[model samples]
Target: MTDQSTVHSVTYDLLRTLKLTTVFGNPGSTEQTFLQDFPEDFSYVLALQEASVIAMADAFAQVTGRPALVNVHSSAGMGNAVGNLVAASHANTPLIVTSGQQHRELVIGEPYLGNREATTLPKPWVKWSYEPARAEDVPEAFMRAYAEALQPPAGPVYLSIPMDDWNRPLSGFDRVRTVSHRVAPDPQRLRGFADRISASRRPALVFGPEVDRSGGWDAAIALAEKLSARVYGAPLPDRAAFPEDHRLFGGPLGMSVKTISDRLAGHDLVVVIGAEVFRYYPYVPGDYLPDGTALLQITGDPAAAAAARVGDSLLGDPGLAIELLLDLVAEGSTRTAPEPMARPRELPQTPNSPLTPPEVYAALSRVRPADAVIVNESTSTMAQQLEWLPTTRTGSFFATASGGIGWGTPAAVGVALGDRDRGVVRPVVGLIGDGSFQYSVQAIWTAAQHDLPIVYVVMRNHEYSILKSFAVLEQTPGVPGLDLPGLDIASVARGFGCRAVEVKSGEDLEREFTAALSAGTTTVIVVPTQPQKAML
Candidate 1:
């Protein structure tokens, strides 16, 4: 041992040195020792359930651009968190997911609560997963997990430390080094791709969340301007990569294969930047490509680049790749500017009308602080939200990249925690659906406990409208759980120690929403609206 230190002492030193001072978790008996005499500098964001805890960590990691630490119970806790764990992995969020294992002696006998194969629990999702063979190996495993999580195409990584390991004395790690987290592109290949974009008569750019994650937003816009290309945000983007209000913005692509192909058919060369080659849902059988369109996708994820359905791929940093392309593309007389795309309407106020998603978003647009961080999971109203909200601010929009339903509310709490910790005092707002709200309703308690200033606007449609749409579209008959009845969301929020209110009409919306914002210390305003959807 280099310094002859205890395991807990060494681990604490590493965390403080690395500036990883925040943790999020739901504690259990096995984790009690790890939490003993917990350091005061390290803020622990607590949640009632494992799912909320991981999601809260996921959002914090995304915001801080660093790996956030999360600890869970044994296999049961991991099982509870698997959904959000998969979602975080899909978003490539850098989260160090650690779990407390049963005592080493008991583990051999497959005790009642032992995670028999602990490492396999988060497999295929975590970048690396391990349960150290020896107590001394625990510290080394943690260091490796942190480094691997911060590496490019970053995602969650797992470490299962035996409950007794935290107290073991005389610890030493095999190595301690700085982690480099970038993969620069090959020069020759990048140049050839740039040449294609420069030569194409008609080009389009598909911007995705990685553009934001990789700090490529400026580069994405610069490249589009240089080539005079029409820009479309990749389908169902959890991150708003481009300014929706910009003239260059062509709006988001769709979830169906044929729809995406149809949107890009007019352009000869399509460049998908910093996102998956394409992410489509709802089994609509059709060709992925148009008759003649060619695709070039630039992504940081090796898996995304390798598994692209049809497009050619460039593996590198999204910001770096775009910056290089901007430098390589030459502007000429033939570099004709494309026509500006359709802009979202700033609809005039319709007095005494039924409260709809579009109207609610429009109202929010008028009142919300310009720099507010938007965490949304209003799935059915997502299309309307995208149309109405202009995510011009960088890293302002976030969604469930993995299409998980219950992340929005807890994610909002996590975002507030990050904003507060970073000294970024932007109002954190979450737009969530009633059905999605019920999934993690307990999050309000966490928010209240921390005194986080988060304004939650629940779109109370009293039904799983998105599921209803999908059911009708796919010809699924007699779905029993689609309707959500007798859910008093505001009352429940109040029960969780939140300031809550309900809005029954447009007048109520404007008045109560404004009041919620003013009184916000984790406030919830439930606005019951018609189940009738204007658009799918």
Candidate 2:
């Protein structure tokens, strides 16, 4: 049969046309047909586990701003892939996740590898999920998945193809199409919103990851400066949208409703752009807004806009909306600019004493490359990381939007791969907590195999410190399984074929970290940090 006559050939052509030439996967017996005679131009990134497979694809897509292709085994692999799938969804990373299924003919008989309920497996996490009803429809299904995945509020999508369908004959292929990824805001509505900003005596601007993702960083800065407004990074943002070192930057918004509301108490107007009206965890119940404060939000996510507890939300592209707001709002305001947030106190290195989280971050920050990309999962010390290692550029920072732990390790691998792919190879540093590192530690092997330059700094506090903080907050004392006694993180990294070491002093860390940054191979630096009380 001619190249275009078979389902496999046409599908490969479609993927090539869409520039999804790299595939992340963990192979299984059911996927063999699809792998038969894999094209020379395509690269397959193999991760030891499906969770790692999904996370790597997630960060790769995030950094490259393209829909990444992922292939996993049947039902079992899909189940293994769910945690990172949820993270990818919340982060709005566009991933086209596919799985091999039992042969179409064998599926009816309930074969061992069949994913009978494939469409429902990745539910709520995926934007769309489907199993091709016929062999000829596989390519078309993929095309639809691409569109769904790249659309505004972009997220992961899934498709299931029977193992035997790859070679099925097809008469022709469908014409490829382009989909617009941005949705413009309503001009009149934006104008009305701009009027409110102009009228307010005190205004506050809250920026979120979407601002950075949509290239609105400069616009956000302009808007804040125009109004002499305080700029707060959205709480728990997956990406840094504003330069943290800017004088106007007011630090991150609080994670709780009361905290956020209280922080903005004196502001007459609060404009949250490119994020949810709010994302709250550990429920600290209070008024959604402080007295005499008016809140408004601009976001591309309809669901985020709709789900907001209190706020008038404008649905559209946050970047586009902010650009429009800049023109409509007054050129300048007479109101006094709000004071910048207080900087964290500098903690100097103490010899022989266990290193504090701040000291570790301070050491790394001192030598951090200007273009470095940080994949942070050091949960207990996140505030400290933010304080010490500021993100001043777009796409310089990444964390799980879903508050999930495991995504960081594999995601660092993906970020390095993305940077390499785009020819702007930034140093990738993964600041992962010991508890978090264990979740998908296997992913580092992929980096070793690919010879990517990535430095993984494991903050070994030897416990789930964040959970313990929650226990304190909830008044639930004596929580079992809160502490992790013995985990030799360096040994674990060695097993994964990475150059590994354990360092306890700041001096040692700075030396090893600087060396690892230029190591030209994946390196894991495990630091035994003194445990500190966690803060929300």
Candidate 3:
């Protein structure tokens, strides 16, 4: 006979059926009831803080190519996780975030841990948010959250669960019925796109992260080769979509439209795939395209295409659209190949006191694992790092596109969790700055708690280097609050239960990086950096 006290047993059974074995969270008193009767098969990851929890889940979702399950405490926890959720929304990572609330009955009278509008708190960040009406509906709410999170324009979803729901008896619970969506371009539309590409003399492909997420890399490559076209990655791509070493691959285009237009001036046809129309920094308005140039865009997002200034937009699944376009273009094609662009020029190494940032990146490139995942947050070293560590594979690199600091270190921990294999666990390295590291140093505790192996290479420049550089460029003297003085990052990492080291020279950097990679634990290596007058 089934015992009446085993109400949560069905909930656990449903969780298992949905294959949500890993739960990421930072627990609190309110969450204890929901965490009760935890199954042996399900593993709970304890994040040091709410931001790290959300960032880790975002990375996990990106790497696994599926929606990740996340949990957090009440109001405070949700507040902490907001920043990371915004970043995830911008990157289009599918995540399901759950938060514990006070009992439903107490919500009316301002209970100890009550959140009146818990679902509305994360507005504009989450694609959908809800609080189930009954305890029996909790599992079904999760189903809806998962589906909404994974739909087109994938992003994080939120669900608030009251503490009493877990303890309540279940009645008339039903299985969640899964829904599938098919979004493919019409055959006639694909043919029109192919005709445009085939008719053009000089065509180029601009690929983006959506292509990588949709598993359209091979199809993109085929399309590029079929047209013998040069391919450029979109400005500030959050993830890699094509191999950088391929002959057809041109380097990343800068964010400015002026810069992009200058680079694309020679080409007559520009085919943008799975990428934004154009993302810019500050105002530097100019012509949307070069003289007489035409644009064609194929994307999974209809809104993105509709918003583009100049383009023949085809809204559909990237893989299917590219495949059909290739089939259509197979009949007639011209072999007009443009002169190959020169390889990225290597930055000259300098022997300056308090090491240059590029030299540090060069040293990192030498010692880092060939297949390691890089999480970059060194704002001053943005141009230099990209030049030095050009990734050849998709999903091997990560960065915060929202320009928010403190994401690199925690995101690295999350990436390691999502991809753990035998022999040498894939090295997750953070190239972060001193000022940025201070913002999220607490994440080191999460790494230690989970025994997650990661190497944080802090560029210790001793100031808000980027801001200082900007001040210098403007010729402003005596800028207050730009200096970050006397903070020992290595000691802080060690205090948080991570191995730590400080590198004063190039020799020290090379030796310590090798040791950290093989140590098989979280390690922080601080490389003393110098302030550069110009952005590298």
Best by TM-score: 2
lDDT of 1 at 507: 63
Clash-forming residue pairs, model 2: none
| Pairs that clash in candidate 3 | none
Q: Give the alpha carbon lDDT tens digit for every residue of 1-536 in model 1.
A: 23457787778778877777888999988888778778888888889999999889999888888889998988999989998998899999999998889998899899877887998888888999999888877777778888999998899999888888888885455467788888888899899998888888888889998899988888887778777788998888888888887778887877778778878887888889888878888768677888788999899999999888988898998888888887898773376676676654655455434477777877787778888889998888877887777788789999998888889999998898888777788888899999999888898899999988899999888899988888888899898889988998988999999999887666677777677676758899887766645232
Q: Determine which window of 10 residues in candidate 3 has minimal summed lDDT.
A: 1-10
Per-residue accuracy of model 3 over 234-338 as CA lDDT, tens digit each: 877777787776888877776666778887888888988888887665335677889989998888877788788787888887877887888787432466664
Output the lDDT of residue 408, model 2. Answer: 96
Local distance difference test, candidate 2: 0.90
C-alpha lDDT of residue 137 in model 1:
78
Provide the lDDT at 170 for model 1. 54
Cα RMSD, model 3: 2.7
Q: After superposition, how far is residue 78 of candidate 1 from its true place, in Å?
A: 0.9
- What's the CA error at residue 251 for candidate 2, in Å? 0.9
Tens digits of per-residue lDDT, candidate 2, 151-183, equal: 999999999899999999877676789999999
What's the TM-score of each model vs. the native?
Answer: 0.96, 0.98, 0.92
